[model samples]
Target chain A: MENFTPGASFLGGVLIGLSASLLLLCNGKIAGISGILGGLLRPVRDDTLWRVFFIAGLLAGGAILRLVSPQVFDIALTRSGEVFLLAGLLVGFGARLGSGCTSGHGVCGISRLSPRSLLATLIFMTAGIVTVYIVNTFFGGAL
Target chain B: MSTLVTSFLAGMLFAVGLGLSGMTQPAKVVGFLDLTGRWDPSLACVMLGAIAVHAPAYRLIRRRSAPIFAAAFAIPTRRDFDLRLVGGAALFGIGWGLGGFCPGPAITSLPSGHTAVLLFVPAMVAGMYLHTLVEGLQVRRSGIVHPETVSRSPTLPPSPALQYRHDA
Candidate 1:
């Protein structure tokens, strides 16, 4: 925990935003993680290849990073893998119900000045804040 | 070859960013939010870093009428903040607090061979299908289904009927 540095985080965010922006510039997509994964379920033959490659590249990046700088990748999931998985599902549910995720609404959506994105981003951030408060205070950090 | 390729590469870069920032791991996310103990600020850094990098690019995108890949720009025109927004946010919060992973990190983590992702991804997909199912049922019950189906394009302006917007 003490080892966490703002520099690395900032660099990572920059990369995320840049990647998102470039995707928008080139693919004209929102870089919404949910939408990308959702596409996998009913993939068009023409669209299937790119999505697979995109996802594969994501995994490869992590593996490569782990290989290059194991220290940088030291953070591990503290919760039982099951809990994290359930949490992931809920987030997905929420993102769909709300029509986008943080990347869509929080990043690209807001940047685009879409009113829906603004509202969605607000919900996303608030949910994150409340979740932290409840988990740390009410639950006594049980999770 | 054009937009898809560009976006695919961009998506890869985004994945790399998550990998580099330690976001792909749920523990760090949970630890940062732990507040009571570890209280990690890595998420903040991720947000800040993303904002800084996109500032310039955003300006350029704004100048364009529409993106290159699609026929027109992708923008949601609704202005009201309504029940759907509030309710969804509440649901999102509970889930995030209970589980450290958000949709982006959760999906990205899937290829990493994490067992949690195995559980989460399916649950997430099921949830999505359920929403669509419920909506389909509602439309059928009304006997006004065909017109509704015709109006369901992402590019179409968001209709309040499809989503309750508060700004109205």
Candidate 2:
């Protein structure tokens, strides 16, 4: 609520969409973060370099943003390190198992009107909402 | 070279969008996911904006025979709502709610040098690699033929067994 900026969010969404389109149009790839990063964990030789560069580009994005508008990034977390690790593990496993996440399933897949992505987006969001509710209402805001 | 450049640019652009959209901030993401509380609807705009541009662009792009760099479009074309898809997404939602960081924003925010991301990314990677390794073993255990392990590169390869869903 304190930092909500609808206009910027919408603009950023367009940027994200443009990026996804760029990948599909040019390299025939989805701009899914988990999929892209997941590929690196396995490290296929021919497919590795492009992923590395893409990740490098991601790092560069943060760097550029920091240099230009540091306030745009507020990477704060209320959760403990152990919880983050657990969450990260689940995210990794789930995304791999599920095959996509917010960007991939929620944005790109759904845009194509893929029923699978729609189901994914709905399920994940519902799960997320429920989890947040549990954490806030029971666990004192973080688990 | 074109592949590298385009991929890199796309990655950068995506990260920038995530940052600007407030997706990099765990609190903001949590706000969006927390529907009952002081729910923030900014992420809705982000999703709408992304789909508005991407869906149409995707439909248009499919008209092309092949991408400029790749031999053929390397997109997923599977259509199924199998248990794995539902179960995996359910798990991911728990993680997203718990940590407020999906893989993209989590990685994208690393350069900010936050402690949470520092801890989270490595663990996420470990989980990802571990899942594939375990699943790979399970496939072999079930007497299924070895799945295609070398058709793609080190970055996210297609999940042949567990996930056949098209690239979202």
Candidate 3:
């Protein structure tokens, strides 16, 4: 439809960063989705409820937001369902491999002045930049 | 469970922000990353929002004796930049430029079912694991001291579960 504004992206980043920092500050945990989801893959008996609740909350949040801000919602899935599923798997694996996801490292890690996080965040951002170029240029929209 | 609960709430909020900000779309993210060209300044706003909201929250949280989990705070303090750091950055740059998704936003948007992110995210994760494995092997092979391996101070001790909390 209309071109999205930079204001929204900035606000969104702020919200994401705030949410992540608040969680870490209060809960002493990194809000890395990969780690949380990975934990679900092979969860301990004591942990099942929390993880389930956490993921459920995530879904509820989206649905609620959609209802609250229909104009802002603008919901759209950019890729096929099959592709999305595959991406989810890779991200899950990457989060574990990296020891944390972007939220964990990019937000919380960097905020805390963790050297590993700074490096991780840098890498993560760089990867994101490169992926966009390749996709838009050589890969075509098929990617 | 506690950690999961907290993280879940955080993720939900994150998802809300992503949706509201139009970050769930690859075109949007890629647009923001196109600094040298069209130079979308929208992503900067996100960074500002995060920074503005987080400054105070961080102050309060850092004052705590320990986190709400079991043992301690997990803040890392490695200051030195090394090859691992540089190489990882390069790889991450390549992926992001190619795929239009990084680990954080990519994971947040998964529920929406974006196809390209589906591909980019896994590759991102694989890269992460690959980094870890390679790092381990490197450590074993050369014994070249990685500056990051050393811990300066013992991390804050973990505290017992506390009451529900939220700060923005």
* Candidate with best DockQ: 2
lDDT of model 3 at residue A27? 61
Kindly report which residue stretches of model 2 are placed more than 4 angstroms away from their true locations once superposed: A1-3, B147-167
**iRMSD per prediction, in order:** 3.6, 1.3, 5.5
lDDT, candidate 3, B52-121, per-residue tens? 6665676678788887663565453345555544554454444444444545556555454434554655
Deviation from native of the Cα of residue A39 in model 1, angstroms: 4.8
| Evaluation by DockQ, superior candidate among 2 and 3 | 2
Which lDDT value does model 2 have at B133? 91
Q: Please give, for residues B88-120, the per-residue lDDT of candidate 2 as tens digits.
A: 899999999999999888888888888898988
The 10 consecutive residues of candidate 1 chain A with the worst lDDT sum are A70-79
Which is the better candidate, 2 or 3, if ranked by TM-score? 2
State the displacement of the C-alpha of residue A134, model 2, in Å, after optimal TM-score superposition.
0.5
Question: How do the residues A1-143 of candidate 3 rate in per-residue lDDT, one tens digit apiece?
Answer: 24647677667877787676756665665565555555554444554565565556666666666567544433232445454444444444444545555556666655656676677666766666555555556655344
Ranking by lDDT: 2, 1, 3
**Full-model lDDT for every candidate:** 0.65, 0.85, 0.55
lDDT score at residue B81, model 3, on the 0-100 scale:
58
Clashing pairs in 1: A26-B3, A27-B3, A77-B27, B32-B40, B80-B166, B80-B167, B81-B166, B81-B167, B82-B166
